[model samples]
Target: MYTQTEIIKDTTINGSEGELVINVGPQHPATHGVLHLVITLNGETIKKIEPHLGYIHRSIEKMCESLTYRQFIYVTSRMDYLSSHINNEACALCVEKGLQIEVPARAKVIRVLMGELTRIASHELWLGAMAMDLGAFTPFFYTFREREMINEIMEDTCGARLTMNYMVAGGVAMDLHPDFQRKVKLFVTQFKKRVPEFDDLITNNIIFQNRMKGVGVLSGEDAISYGCTGPVARGSGVSSDIRKLYPYDGYDAVAFDEVLETAGDSYARYLVRLREMHQSIRIIEQLIDAIPEGDFQAKTKAVLKLPKGEFYTRVETARGELGVYIVSEGGTTPYRIKFRSPGFSNLSALHHMAKGSKIGDLMATMGTLDLVIPDIDR
Candidate 1:
C-alpha cells in the first residue's frame, strides 16, 4: 500500500490512558470491495479511521461525455449493478427532462415497480452479505434464492438481470413482459411469506445483537453532515428519502411509510433494510394489480437531440440519491455528463463512523453501509 505522509497521523484511541492502531482491508471481505482502512483502536474500541479509495476507478463520467444520450444510459447500469434499475431511472429522467418528453402513465408505473423490485433485491443481497460478514452463511443462500427469482423476472422482462437497461429517455426500452404482472405478484406473495423468517433467523438472534447493537452508532445530525442516506440515514432518524422529498414518477401516488430507526448502528441499518424489503413488496403489491395500459415507448425523431441547456435529475436509489447531470448543446451527443452517485456519498461516512472502533466492527460498519464499488469509482 502506498502511504502519503501528509495524510498520515498517529491514530490512537485515548481513554485517559492508551491506544492501538491496526491496518484493515484492501482485501478483507468486510470492507465490501477493495476498501482499505488504516484503523486506530484501543482494546476493541475504534479511535480514528482513514479510508483509501481509487482501487477501481473506470472514469465512467468522462467516458459518458463522448457517448450519445441513448448510449450513455447503459453505462449507469454498471455504476450500482445491484440497483441498476434506479440508476437507469435517474439517467432516463435527466434525458427525458432535457428532451422535453413525457413518459406515459403506464411507463411511470412500470418504472416504479421495477425500481422497487431492484430496491428489494439490493436489500436482500445486503442482508445476506451482512450476515455472512458476521460469520453466518446459511442466510446468504436463503436470501439469494429469493433474489434469484427477482433476477429471473428482470431477465425475462428487460433481457438483462443485474444491469437492466430497461428505461430509456422517452419511455421504457420495451414493455413489461406478457407475464410480468403474474411473475411479480408471485414474487411479492412469496417474499411477504418468507421475509418474516429472516427476523427469526438473524435479527432476533442473540449472536447478531451481541455483534451489532450499539456498534458504529451515528446520530441523526452526524449522519446528515456525513452525507448518509437511504437506509443508513433513515436508521439514524433522518428522513432523507428522495421519494418523499421529490417524487419523480408515480411515487407521489403510492401509499407507503418511510421506514426509519433511531438507533443508527449496525443493527439499526440491518433492521431498516429488513423492513424496507417488506415496504417495497407492499408498493409492488398495489401496482401489480393493475399494470395499466399504454405504449411502451414514445415517438421520437430519427436522432435524439436535447435542447441547448443543462438538466439534472435525481432518484431515490436503493443506495441513496443518484443524480444525473447533463448539458446539451442541441446535438445528438451530450456535452457533459456527471453522475452524483449515492455510494460515493455514502462511502464518505465510513471514516466518520469507523473512528474509535474495532477491526471486527469495521466489517459490521462497512457492510451496513451497503456500498457498491462501481458507484464510488464512477
Candidate 2:
C-alpha cells in the first residue's frame, strides 16, 4: 500500500514503454468529489485506470456500531448525500426489520413518495453535472432550475435540503407540510413541460450522442460481474431494480415501469436515468392524492432495542441498491453494522469500461457512472 505522497510521486514517473501515468483527481472538478484516478495512457488511449480512494472516508459503518438505532440513520445521509433520504430509509428499514416493528400504512406511503422525489432530484442534478462534464454548460443551469424546486419542497417538509434525516424506524419525523401537496404538484407540472427542453439542449444533439453512444461500453455480463445495479446495470439490460424485485415501503403498491436499455454504453445509461425521472413522476402521481389520513408514525417504546440476532434491509437509492446490515446483541446500540453501497461496486468496473477507450472519452464514461465519491469512501 503506497502512501498518498508516494502515489503522487508514482504519477510523475513514466510507465514501461511509452505509457504515461497521470492523475485525474483527489482534487479535480470532473470527479464531482474527492476521487483520485491514476490512469495509464499510451498515446491518448487508456491502458488502465486505477482508483485511489479514502480521501473522504468517514468510517460510517464503524460509527454506526456505536450509535443507537435512531442515531445511526442520520449518519448515512452523509454517504450518498444526493440520495440522503433514500440512504436514511435504508438504515431505518434495517432497524425496523431487526425489531419487527410494524410501520404504519400512511408512513409507508410517505416513505415511498419521499424516496421517488429524492430519486428524481438526484437524477436531475446528475444530468446537469454530467452534461457540464461533457462541456455542455447550459443544461447544468436548466436542470438545476427544476432540482431547486425539489430542494425547496424537501426543505419545507424535512427542514433540510441536502441531508434530510426525515426517515425514522417506524415513520417520518413529522407530518407533511400543509403546502407540500400543492408545491409538489406544481413542480411536477412545470418539470413535465421542461423535460423536452433537455432533449433539445443536449440529449438529442448529434455531438453529444456521438460522444456517448459507443463510449465506455459494458456488457450485461460484465456489469453483473462487477456488481453494478440501478441505472448502471439496467442500462446493460440487467433486471436489477431492487424496488421491482424486492418491494418495500409501499413500492409494490405503486405502478411504475422498470426502465431498461440494451446498449450497455454511456448513452444507454444516460437514457435510463432520463426515462427514470418520468417513472418517478408516475409513482408520485399515483400516491400523491391518496396519502392515507392516519397516524404518520407508528407507536413504539421510548427506547429501541433489537433482539440478539442479525438483520438486513435493502432499498433502491437513486444511484443503485443500498443494503444495511446490522448485528444486535439485545442492546440499544448495534454490535456491528455494514453497508453495501452501490457506488463502490459500480466503480469496480471503471477499468473494464475505460480500457482501450480514448482518454477524452473517460469523462463521458465516468460521468455516466454518476459516481458520488463520499458514497464510495464511506
Candidate 3:
C-alpha cells in the first residue's frame, strides 16, 4: 500500500529499473474527456499515475470576473456539462445571497426538481460509461436508452439537452412546460422498471464483480483528506452530502437518504451512484405532486448588482459539492470568482487510489471517479 506522502512524491523504486511508462490519454475514449494519464508500470501492476490536464481550459473564473453577474452563471455549464443545472443553480444562489433576493416558493421547488433530474441523468451516463470501461458493451446501450428520456424532458422544458443555462439570479429562466409533469411522471414510471435491468446486466455479473470488488479502495479518512466528494466520498462512508448538510432551494422539505457504503472500493462507489439515482427519484416524487402554484421566477431588477461583499453558495451536483464563491465590489460584474468543482478534487486522488493496483484495474478506478476534465481545467 502507498501512503499519501509517497504517492504525492511519486517515487520510483531504485532496484526496479526499466519499468514501462505509458500515456493513457489526451484523446482516449475511456478517459471520458481530454485527460491524459501517465502511468508507470511494473509488469501489470501500476506504480504511479500522474494526470496531465488543461486540454480544455476555458479560464471560466476569470471570464466570470469580466462578464456581468447574469451572464456569468451560464459559463459554469460548460465546466461540468453533466451537472449543468446544479452548476447554474449554485452560481445563481450565490448571486442571490449577495443581492439578498428571496426566491419564490414555486421557483424553489422547480429548481429542486430540475436539480434532481440532472443528478439522475448524470448517474445514468456514468452507469453506462463504467460498464463499458469494464468491457460490458451492452450495458452502455441499456443505460443510454434510459438517459435519453431525461434529455427529452430537459429539451421539452429547458430548451437545451446538455447545457440548459436556464437559471438566473432570482430563479429559473422560464416556467415548466405544460406537459412537464405528465412527461416526468411517465419517465419516472418507465425508468423504475429499467433500473433493475442494470443489475442483471452488469452489477451482478461475476466478471464485473471480480474486476471491481477489492480494486482501488479509497479509505474514508483519505477520501476526506483529499477532499473527495459525491459518490466517491460517500462510498468511503464519508457523510458529506451538501444537500443534507446545508439545505437550499426547498431541499429541507424533501426527504431522501444520503447513500453510503463502507467498502471504499471501486464497486462501493459504483453502488453508491446507482442507489443515489433511486434517491433522486424519491426526491422528485416527493416534490412533483406538491409543486406550488405561483410565478416560476421572482421579480428582480433588469440590471442586477450585488452589495459590496463576499458570498458563497453550495449545491449538491451529480458528481458532488459544487461551491460558487464571489467577491463583489457592489457592481454588476464580480470582483473575483472561484468555482470549487468536485471533479478537480476527485481527480487529485487518482494516483493515491491507483497505486499498487493492476494496470487493468486503472480503467475500473477511473470509471468510478467519473471525471470531467473541463471541470478540472476550469
Worst 10 residues of 3 by lDDT: 1-10
Report clash pairs, candidate 1. Answer: 46-356, 46-357, 47-356
> What do the candidate models score in CA lDDT, each in turn?
0.85, 0.93, 0.90
Q: Which ranges of candidate 2 are over 4 A from the true structure?
A: 1-14
Ranking by TM-score: 2, 3, 1
Query: What TM value does model 3 have?
Result: 0.95
RMSD of 2: 1.6
The candidate, 1 or 3, that scores higher on lDDT is 3
* Model 1 segments more than 4 A misplaced: 1-21
On lDDT, the candidate that comes out on top is: 2
Q: How big is the positional error of residue 242 in model 1, measured in Å on the Cα after superposition?
A: 1.0
